[model samples]
Target: MFITKVFILIIIASITNINNTSALKLECTYREPDLHWEAFSRDYTCEGTIRLDGDDENIRTVTNTHREQMRNADVRGLMIVQQRDLQKFPKGLERHFHHLIGIDFEDCGLTKISSDDLMPFKELLQINLSGNRLTELPNDLFQFNPKLKKIDLSGNLIMHVGLEIFNNLQHLTMINMHDNACTSDNAYATKKEELKELVWELSVECPPTLDMLSSSLFGSKEFIDNIKRISGEDSDDVRNELLNEIQGLEKIVQELKRRL
Candidate 1:
């Protein structure tokens, strides 16, 4: 189903002819397998231009109007094509989209996501954010969504990742982050200390599940270069627990490599 959405967006981009600065709009519609366009009228557009930041009053009005129109409706799914460059995740999405099961931000140029605004998407199952420009995620970005199953962050500029972003996500099974800077030595160097802190955190907290240990995220050479940062601690118990965590992580990475 996500692949079908990607194909639709590719077709829309091929047909859409706009100057870079011209404002583009988005609206909600359900598409069948035949790919029907249900509504393209102005009312469904919510009088909003897809943008990250602009006039505060205009932004509020746009989001509020959307909230009013779709209030209390069982909006199971939604897909928005910015059809233009939006430099960040559209604000106020959390206030309006409550029952969303899946969302996509393909090719929309989002640099970062809002940690606070995502609190409403507890039931959200899938999130496809491929082809954005995201650099990092907030530490508690996934705090509200424990049941989330799949996340696709492939084809982004992501470099830094918070330690707690993957914590306690027991249901997450698939995460796609291929072709990002997180695996590169230079980019990992920028956050080497931070990554070490995450590795050290395993002594007290429940280590993230084996599936969440994808190397595309934590596999940079610089990360392994400084992997022994916590070895100097005096407590052998702490060192033993850390060593166990490290072995589990290495095993996960090896499994991932075998699959490739």
Candidate 2:
């Protein structure tokens, strides 16, 4: 009887462990890649779009499987939506979707994006990052994506627009900037002649000099907080050092302007 009881207990423990492992596994469907219309341009083509929609864990699993299946596909666009658990932009996507022309991360919980996140999308034409938790955009966010034509940044928490952000983006004709925290304005170029006016309007809404300085020097408020946490008592010294660096950069900029 003692031996039988011990066997039963072991079996129960094994079953419990199996159940826990199954519970921890993310559940998602791996559907075959379909020829769908691209979200931004509404173009119908087999290689136009790949939609990945789920919570972060499920999407991650699906993305991995899809990447394998679409390894040889000439994928031109990607859309990831309803991902509340996705706080940062998924890196290394350009590895598989190098030919991607448009990317949509709508309704995701993305809080921030860096220049490096977009550095690889050189052939990108349009981007829709609406309905995210983004509070600010990096200064060089679009530096590498010079071929970009359209941008949709509506429905975010962004409060400022930097003048330098749009520099050299001559091909950019439309910008959907409505419903952000800063102002309810949309910039559209009806004709080539009107594009300059729209661009100027976009630049004029930039945050003040002090705010721009903070953003340019530190990248984001969260980064400053992280530095404070890591440096602790030396945070003040670190901040002063950064300010001095900013001053030096300003002097260089002024000299360059004078020379030009």
Candidate 3:
């Protein structure tokens, strides 16, 4: 669901009598005389907007719910800006925000990410991981985020992702994967076939998602074999076969829906 908090902020935005207006809206203001801060204006387009800020810190550090800086009311549309040591995926955030709607980790020097790292924020609609050192995406990357609508993975070292990493993101509309190592279909590249799988899943109609229901309904043998082949060799064949089945089933479901 689209967050009502943003609307509420917009409703009361004109109240000049309020002591703290920044606590209501989603805007980033930059300090003058700092050329580095000026760059943030260009980097984060939202910085130019005149909305009341969430009143978040200049550096949003989220380790746990107990942190003095982390407040429950300000969990929506949070941004962690320019923290170089935020290399590893910080756990326990999921425990705090049961349905975190928006998150921005721009230029935070992120190195890795896992499904568990985001599972806590299951209802996240937008996520920005631009400017990171990520190399490979896990198979279950979006296993927990079915409602995710937009994700920015630009400017990362991402090379490998499963054929089905995005198949289950039911509401995903916008995804940016630019400047990554896996943008090639050339066999000589790091993982050509894996990247090809991502391309195959770029668009769709009706239902627009694949999940356990389709997995159980089709390609049972290949799915079973792919599970075992991971421990052995020749996983590509089984994995591709199952992915093809999943894609095919999605089309069949769409076609069936059209007929009705």
Candidate 4:
């Protein structure tokens, strides 16, 4: 009876530990003005993540050391490093900022983004490499963090987004190539053609199992509200105007469909 009781107690302890471990996800918030760090800056014991909105220009000034200070203060969640030209600095320093969902480097002049620059952060959510000068990204770029959501490659000098670039990134949502030189009339026309072909090929190989749209798809709440002044769900006048334009497009589609 004593031995049986001991085994039961051990099982109970194991179950409790499992529950605690599962429940220990972290939570963090962007430090707001006036509210500052005090409101969201506890000992970082809360569970989930931290988000640095892409518009936060202050992130550019934050050094890896200062970010390390934030990490050592017991904050172990998402740290969104927005638009900092990390590659301009020496290598290995980026490995230090590996505490969060991922870093956003959109429009940060990355002519060459490698997987080595990203290998340290094992728990990355996604990394935004959009609007860079990268002609090619490493093949196994997403292999390290397969949970990657968005890889926005819009406005870059990329000739072609490789077919295998996204093979491991099942959770990837938006791969933006809009407004790129690749899409221009002058360059990468064939590669862009190949990119479109690959999208079609991949769609056939695997139907998209996820809805991968980022929150940035729609502008910020303030911008969306401003858009409402000109065009939104609540704006009946704007809706009517859009409906009129769509009505015109609908006529064109009808004619095309009839021709088909």
Ranking by TM-score: 2, 1, 3, 4
- lDDT score, candidate 4: 0.46
Q: What's the lDDT for all of these models? A: 0.54, 0.63, 0.55, 0.46
- Provide the global lDDT of candidate 1 against the true structure: 0.54
List, residue by residue over 105-149, the lDDT tens digit for candidate 2.
Answer: 778889988788888888888888889988876567898999888
lDDT of 2 at 46: 23
Give stretches of model 2 more than 4 Å off. 1-72, 185-190, 208-211, 214-260
Model 1 per-residue lDDT at 228: 56
Error of 4 at 148 (Å): 0.3
Q: State the lDDT of candidate 3 residue by residue for 67-119, as single tens digits.
A: 34444444455566666656766544444344456667777777888877777
- Candidate 4 lDDT for residue 156: 69
**TM-score of candidate 1 versus the correct structure, residues matched by position:** 0.49
Q: How does candidate 4 fare on TM-score?
A: 0.42
After superposition, candidate 1 runs with Cα above 4 Å error: 1-26, 33-54, 57-72, 82-84, 184-260
Worst 10 residues of 4 by lDDT: 208-217
- lDDT tens per residue, model 1, 93-164: 544544666666667767778556567788767677778888666556778878776666767776655556
The candidates, ranked best first by lDDT, are: 2, 3, 1, 4
Backbone atom clashes (below 3 Å) for every candidate:
0, 0, 1, 7
